[model samples]
Target chain A: MHVIESGNVAAANGVKLARAHVVAAYPITPQTPLTEKLSEFVDAGEMDAEYIPVESEHSALSVCIAASSAGSRPFTATSANGLLYMSEQLHWAAGARLPIVMCVVNRGIGAPWTVWNDQQDAFSQRDAGWVQLFACDHQQIIDTVIQAYAIAETVSIPVMVCYDGYILSHTYMPFEIPDSDTVDGFLPAFSPEYALNPAKPCNLNTVTLPDIRPDVRGDTAPGYMEIRHNLHTDMREALNVIKTVDEKFYSIFGRGGHCFIEPYNCEDAEYIAVCIGSLSYQLRDVVDALRQDRIKIGVCGLRVYRPFPDEAIRETFKSAKGIIVLEKALSYGYEGALYADIKAALYDCDNRPFIHNYILGLGGREIKTQQLLDALRQSCTIDIPVPQWIGLKM
Target chain B: MREDIIQIRWHGRGGQGAITAAKIVASAAFSSGFAGVVMTPTFGTERRGAPVLTSLKISKHKINDLSPITEPDMVVVFDHLLLKEVDVTNGLKEGGIIMINSPRPAADYSYKGMNVFTSDINSVASSVGLPPGIINTGVIGLFAKATGLLDLEPLLQAINIEFEGRNPEKNIEAARLAYENTMIGESR
Candidate 1:
């Protein structure tokens, strides 16, 4: 049924529908409402889950790790400093192959204390080995949460569904809520391959010996190298599983699978703007306007962040004359992370557009569509500048 | 007429339903078979009690510009204090209308070439025992009475749909009171 709701409430509903057995979270601005709604659900007996109120984000992820190790479907959410605090545990969740799903409300990491939208929080954790998906709107936020759980459980890996902090988190929109019966039919209870119990005691997360070989070990024990290789192979196979699960979700829910990249008006275009998060909605207006004026412009919204979705991105930009990358996160000494990834992905293609990285909306700065169009127009005139700032007062 | 769009700029604080009012107005125009777009141009960080600016565009065709409106055909100020902090009438078009929710006499305010409309929407809202945030609904009624760009019936319908029968009568009463109290066509 269609209902007007906030992004936080929709996300909480997604958690309930996914049938998460354990939810561990720490309160943070823009992310507090999500946890609050979930807490309400737990109190009202709507969700039969263990809601762990941990002291800190670090302990929150630790609790989720323990719960998921016991073969329970675990979930958690944090933002900015909270996510930074849980950085070490993020790797643990991924390396343990424990199918944990987390919602990272993308916020600016502060020295100035800003509780606003930015992708820096999640971008800083890019190398943590967890699948990351960026949602563009509230509906995508809800749908991606459901899909994250399915993908994580299927691959036995953790996944993070990221949305802009205050942009989508606080904005109210009309969204469709799938019935519980439909969600149950789509994401059935998770059945894990291993579980911790007193009856069958086994050491988990043990130290590895360099000289150990798989053949020398018994049938029950796998060598450290074999385990690492298995994890790598599982991640490689997860790409296909991600696509399949999204397809299945769409089959059930009637909305999913715009691929890892959604291409708008790219069929015939000379210049394109690549973006993520809520800014894409604004870009749509610019693209439509430019197209009417006979300016060949297009837009590409990147959904999947980890595993990077390189193949789809390269194909999407093959026909463009120039590419403008709008990023909400800045890499200290380096250019925007998404721009760097896209450049690396399309380095070998002939006649590749001059890729420009524009860092805008950092520390909660507002980004209007006209600024995006201005950047695109500038890209056509001069060589696309590196780390250009949009909407800056200077 | 080139059928050009009439862009409206709304100024209000967070939690005052300014964004909601813009959306409802746009939805009402769209429901009446006109094209419209509503957007919030937010900056820095927004918290409750902080000022916010939201814009709405009603066009005969699709809205093409997504930029902040520097000059607006109409300006709706939800708070009287905003006039001192920011120039609410800065880019108001000639003969444009400025609707403010203030108890002071409309003649007391100065507008060089624009028409000024004033109402005590908060008073009307309080009289109906409605929350102050519902002042937007009253402003929408004033907007309808002054501009005639949107039909009051469709706006009330949109409000009913949005509230889902919760406090609809109070909102309708507020709208009717605002419509009755608003004085338009006064040049200052």
Candidate 2:
């Protein structure tokens, strides 16, 4: 049924349709509404999941990790400080190879305290070995959440579906809620090979020495280093899994499948604006306006961050003369993290475009359509400087 | 002619349901054949009695812009008291529509370059036996009447969907009363 709803509500419906066995989270701004909706679903008996309200985000993720390790599909959500608080458990969940799905409503990190939209919160957790997927709108939020579960379970790795807080979370849009039977057809039940069962009694994650050890049967087994290596291998496999799951979803529902990075009007273009989240929705207008003036410029919204869609990045911008990366997070003294990744991806190209990074809209700064056009006009002149902060104070 | 995309800003207190009004208005616009409708609120910890601002953007196609509406085509003030506290007229487009929940005649209020419309939403709310404090939905009716951007039945439907309880009938009646009573003010 098509109903007008907020992104948080769409996300909660995604969890309900997926029939997540364990829903655990700490109530935080933006993200609080998502979990609250889930709690309502559980209370109304609309969903048959155990909704665990934990004391802190740390406990929230730990609950998910425990539930998933015990053979149940678990889900959790947080933003900014809450995600930071659970950083330790973030690594543990991936290390345990638990197929847990988490929604990180991206918010600006605090010192001055802002509860607005930004990608920094989720970007900070890039090294945690979890697949990061960013959605551009509320519909993508719903579609991605369902796909995240399938991808996570397939690779035995956790996935974090991140969308801009308040911008997407609080915004209302009309989206079709996929029926549970259709969702089940796309995503089957979880059946783990190994679990925390006393009848089968096996010590999971026992202390392994640095050196490779031989088993009781005299077979050489993987060491701690090998375990980490396997995690890396799985991360690589997730690239394919992400695409496959998105394709499966598109087949079921008429909407998804262009999963990794969404390229808009990039073909036959000389310049491209690289960005993520709802801001990209606005940039499309800038691109269209510029196109009317006959400036061949386009935009590519980076959807999946972790198993960084390097190939897609290269393929999309290979024809462009200049690639401008618009990011909401800064790496302190260095360029934006996305800028570094894009540059690295295109390093081997013989005719690499001048990749420039512009850190804009940090701390929820409003990015006007004219400002974007002005930046694009300035970028047209070669030798554009890196880390050009949009609407920055002196 | 109507714009390809319509931008509206809401001025109200924290407890006045400006966010709720924005969402319902966006939903109403979507149901009225605008394929894209986005409603957003000012992000922060909202407290009752504090100033709150919300925005709604409606387009015929998919809306690409996510920024707050800086230059609004229309502005709705849920509480007339907000006029003194905030510059409710700031960044309003030329000949923009301004709807306020005031008992005074629209002719009595004048902005330098805009059309001001007035309706006594509080009176309508009370006439419909709604609680004394809740006048947000009533103001929305005034908005629909003043702008004519959305159809009356869809706006009423959106309100009913939002308030899916025993009092939907009353809320719909209150909206109808406010719609019938809205008055157009002079643009100086």
A322 Cα displacement, candidate 2 (Å): 1.0
Q: Of the true contacts between chains A and B, what fraction does model 1 have?
A: 0.09
lDDT of 2: 0.88
C-alpha lDDT (0 to 100) for residue A71 of candidate 2: 94
Q: Which candidate's DockQ is highest? A: 2
Q: Give the poorly placed runs of model 1, Cα more than 4 Å off.
A: A211-217, A223-225, B1-9, B13-73, B90-97, B104-115, B130-137, B143-172
Off by over 4 Å in 2: A216-218, B1-3
CA-based DockQ, model 1: 0.22
Residue lDDT tens for model 2, B1-188: 12588899999998888888888888888888999887877766669988889888898988877677888999999878889999988899999999999988889897988999989999899999999868888988898999989889999999999999758888898889989999998788
Candidate 2 chain A weakest ten by summed lDDT: A376-385
State in Å the error of residue A63, model 1: 2.0
Top lDDT hit: 2
Clashing pairs in 2: A281-B64, A282-B64
Against the true structure, whose TM-score is highest?
2
Q: After superposition, how far is residue B68 of candidate 2 from its true place, in Å?
A: 1.1
For each candidate, the DockQ is 0.22, 0.62
Assess each prediction's global lDDT (C-alpha) against the native.
Answer: 0.82, 0.88
